[model samples]
Target: MNQPRPIFGTTIFDGSQARKGYALNRMCFSFNDAANRAAFKADEEGYMRSYALNEQQSAAVRGRDVLGLLAAGGNVYYLAKFAGILGLDVQDLGAQQTGMSKEEFKARLVRQNDQPAATAG
Candidate 1:
C-alpha cells in the first residue's frame, strides 16, 4: 500500500473551519473594496471588532502570523488580501509556513523541480 503523505504546517479547511473563520474571512473579503481596505488600514482594531473576530483570529491578525491564522481557520485566499495590505505575497507566506527564509524556500522549490517525479506504488 502507498502510505499517505504526512501533511504539515496547516489544517484542512472544512465546514468546521468555515464556521470558525466566518468573521475573519468576511473581514478579508471586505478588503476587496478600496474604501473598506482604507477603513481597515485606518482602524484595524475597530475593523476586527466590527467583524466579530474571536481572540485567536484577532491575535493572528495583530501578529501577522500566517500559520497562526491558518490554525485559527483563516482561508489562504482571504488571508492573501490581508497579506497584500501588509506588502506580503504568497511566496512570503510559503516561507513562513515552512519556517524558512524566502530565498531558501525558493531554492528548495528549484531543487524539487530538478528531481524526477516519484512513481506511484
Candidate 2:
C-alpha cells in the first residue's frame, strides 16, 4: 500500500507582497460597493486608479492575477483581503471540511509540508 501525497492548492504571500494585496483589496472593495459602483461606473478609470501603487503595483492589481501580484511583491494578508473583495469567503471554504478555521487550514499546510513525501509503488 502507498500513502497519498498531501495536496496544496492555495497561494500564500508574505511581507510587502501581503501589504500590496491588502491595499489593492481595499481599493477593489471600495469600487465594488453599491454606492461606489455607481460612482465607478461614471468614471471607471478614475475609480480604478490607485495613488499608493507604483507602476508595478498598478500593474499587479490591473492584472487580477494573484500569482503575478506575488511575483510583483504581495503578501498573504493582502491576498486574503483580495479574496474578501472578490466575495471568496476563505473562512466558509475552510469550514466546509470538518469545520476547520482558516487559521487551522493555514497551520495544516505547514504541518503537511513538514511531513515526509509519500511514495507509491
TM values, all candidates: 0.89, 0.39
Give a tens-digit lDDT track for model 1, residues 17-64: 899999999999999999999999999999999999999999999999
Quick one: how many clashes does candidate 2 have? Answer: 8
- The window of 10 residues in a row where model 2 has the poorest summed lDDT is 90-99
- Predict model 2's lDDT versus the native: 0.56
Once model 1 is optimally superposed onto the true structure by TM-score, how far is the C-alpha of residue 9 displaced, in angstroms?
2.2
Pairs with steric clashes in candidate 1: none
- Residues 1-121, candidate 2: write the lDDT tens digits: 9644544643444455456555555655464357765664475456546335556656755655555555555553545555555565655445433346667877887888999998998
Misplaced by over 4 Å in model 1 are: 1-6, 118-121
lDDT value, residue 43 of candidate 2:
59
Q: Over all chains combined, what TM-score does candidate 2 have?
A: 0.39
When superposed on Cα atoms, how far off is each prediction in RMSD? 3.0, 11.1
